[model samples]
Target: MKIFRILQIMSLIGVLIPMGCSDFLEKKSQDEVIVTTVSDFDEFLLGSGYVTYVQYANLYFLDDDIEYYESEYYDELSDVMASYGFQSWQPDMWESEEVIRTNWETYTSTYSRIMGVNAVLDGIDKARGEIEARDQVKAEALALRGYYYFMLVNTFGEPYNYNKKALGVPLKLSADIEENGMPRNTVEEVYMQIVEDLRESSALFEKYPKRRGNYRINLPTVNILLSRVYLHMERWDSVIVAANKAIQYSEGLTDYTKFSGSNFFMCSYDHSEVEWIYGVGVNIQFFGPSADLLSRYDKNDCRPGMWFDMGEYSTNRLLKKDYDWMSGSATPVNTVRISEAYLNRAEAYVQKGMTGEALADLNEVRCNRITGYTNIENVPANLLEEVRLERRLELCFDEQRWFDLRRYGMPSITHRYRYRKSDPWVIYTLREKDPLYTLPLPNEAIRNNVRLEQNASAYEPKRSGVEE
Candidate 1:
């Protein structure tokens, strides 16, 4: 977990800031771009644009070790799952002191990247060349801007579907900078702008052939992101359309056969069929977990099996046939799969008053779980509730359950257990949030940005070493 933190923190400054956030809106065209007049702003598209870089600064990287162990921290900084090898964090997990703070810091990079995009957006209005290519640049710049805003809004602001029109990061659309000490914009305004950016990004990126290579953005990734944003806003129609479009370009549904293959566990961003779009590579590793969480599963499960199993029903550690006492490096695969699209569609359908259609999508995902079960024809009328629960169980250990629970606006579930690895089992809460339900921005960020204010409830303990 400490290693993950080192990587995330390092990238915030080393990777994103130093690199100049160019990739955030870089163009791939080989043709030399030529600018003519302000009317030739499209020509600026030919000029070197900033590349888009997605820094996957993880939760474990954001907070100290203790927060990583607990799925929920009473105070956000106190407990987090990144310590146990989960890179993802929930927005509602506002209490993960660093989650909010580091994510806020992550903005330094994202917003910095946006400046590059905005520079192009501002500059291109005059220089011009291929009208279509120029148009594509315009679209990409807008989309890139939207993508960053989405990340910032999701992390710092409230969900679009919910309340409040007050305060979010400053809306810096152009690169020509002025005041660095801008407060936030209203959440309502941010969402509206975000909607415009994504819609435009989707349109622009779609003009080009899909981008491939380990970490580049392309048409499909934009679709996947738009779908996610729509989900947050509860725009069911847009979510369904975007997800389905993304799935069209998707490859395979599962790599169960190769799941534990060489370097599969920590290798970051593998080529799995279900991945519609992914950015920022990160390796995965297992570390701290309070023991009791392990007690629920069979002893053989790699994650749940690390500890002793009570085995009220069985004695031996039950290993999944696929794991095969796996050893050595295992690559990490972190992308929303086609399975996720099905899940998203299920929710959209449920909202659209199409329970039967929703159930079909839900079952499609359930039927494929490594721990498979029959998809029931009689899915409950409360399909949303069932979807929420399935998301928790199905997505557990995927760095997702924590966020899923928080996004659904439910108090997350918890349990207690001891550290059984080197000693006996102990008790601890697996999940919980405190104060305003969000962790304070990290102390470092609070001190860095004058415009940035600390959430009163947020504060993490001083750490002696890297988070273990």
Candidate 2:
């Protein structure tokens, strides 16, 4: 089936299946399908625009935050080894036959959703409903489309701040299927479109001013995403502006002082600080926290007690808050929280040389998370470094670490991998500013779109360092 047509069945499925009739004779022709109401478009938007399922778990392996250990039963799971390229920072991670088991969904899923949102945007203006209702639906579809593009440009293209002219994922704004093999857009072009979509979304939402549920995009979520995008573009003042706007809508930070141990793990879905809940939660079976990440938390910090736990294998430490190995479901995914607004502002302040303001924002988070934490009164010499550390600690596994590492000059990282617990360790190194910083277009994507060119691979000459 064509990717653009994925959402056409959304309305039919919603209308027919619920009536308990699966007969094809009851179905209407594609030309007869009418989604002409605000409610109809709203329902269509939910089924297509929202990424509630696990899509980008492979993103975790690219960062230094995770450590991989093969279990005694590792041989039983052929799929687990598909991420070897990602863990080693190979450019072919998405394209290589060795990594075939890894399902690269970000490219396909984002475009599918964009097509869905495009359909809504194309038709919502004509839908029969109150002006306010139609506007709100338009606002939501715009926000979702902007978000999908942001994720796409960031994942497949070079960091905007690094090289705005670099090749980005293909840009598709219309629901109407264009010719096959659409070419890539520049990073700057994609970012401009993202900003434009998000700003338009914000204006429409503000005009309507109806509160959307936490599960859906609202005014706060739009501003928060804007802040993140600005942060990536190195627009420090814009970051501060957007972050402050989002902070005003937030309830406040979640104090770690209130929670302890596995008695109750703190999940972001129900937390007060959360602005949006989307994305796949971490699974310990595939990856665990690196020693470097765990070391960043001070002994006085309460997060370790709330976040990490011993995995099913005694040797592994799993992110308890992400996924409880016991009876707890592994459903927690991407959470955009108020605390990130604070961190974003803090980083922006430091960049703009507002050290005191930066420390104030930084310490606000620390005071809440640490026991008996005294505010850092004076500006520390490494205030910028301090803010980065705090961000890694607060936002670890929330899908910010890898991007942060990229924007932080794509520092060299080393990973130790073993096929099994008893096997000798093999070291994989990603050199500073490696071409792999920008991920490859999925092999299938290139095969389908002949206009697409793959990014340069980091694995030049394919060197796998000496084993330990």
Please name the candidate that would achieve the greatest TM-score relative to the true structure: 2
**Per-residue lDDT of 1-468 in model 2, one digit per residue for the tens?**
112243253342222223233221122455334566778778767666677565767777889888875444555344456667777766566665545444444677567677778878888888878999888889889889888888888888998889999988888887775555688999999999988998898888778544634467787788888888899999999999889878877778888787766564555545667777765555546467777888889889988767766456543355544544455554545677788899999999999999999999999999989999999888999999999999999888776788888889999998887656567788898889988878777766777678887777533555475696
lDDT of each residue in 17-61, candidate 1, tens digit only: 222433322322332222344333332222222333224444323
> TM per model?
0.62, 0.89
* Model 2 vs. true fold: TM: 0.89
Evaluated at residue 131, the lDDT of candidate 1 is 61
Q: Where is model 1 more than 4 Å wrong at Cα?
A: 1-104, 124-140, 208-214, 249-252, 255-336, 371-375, 393-403, 410-433, 442-468
Give the clash count for each candidate.
54, 0
Query: Once model 2 is optimally superposed onto the true structure by TM-score, how far is the C-alpha of residue 411 displaced, in angstroms?
Result: 0.8
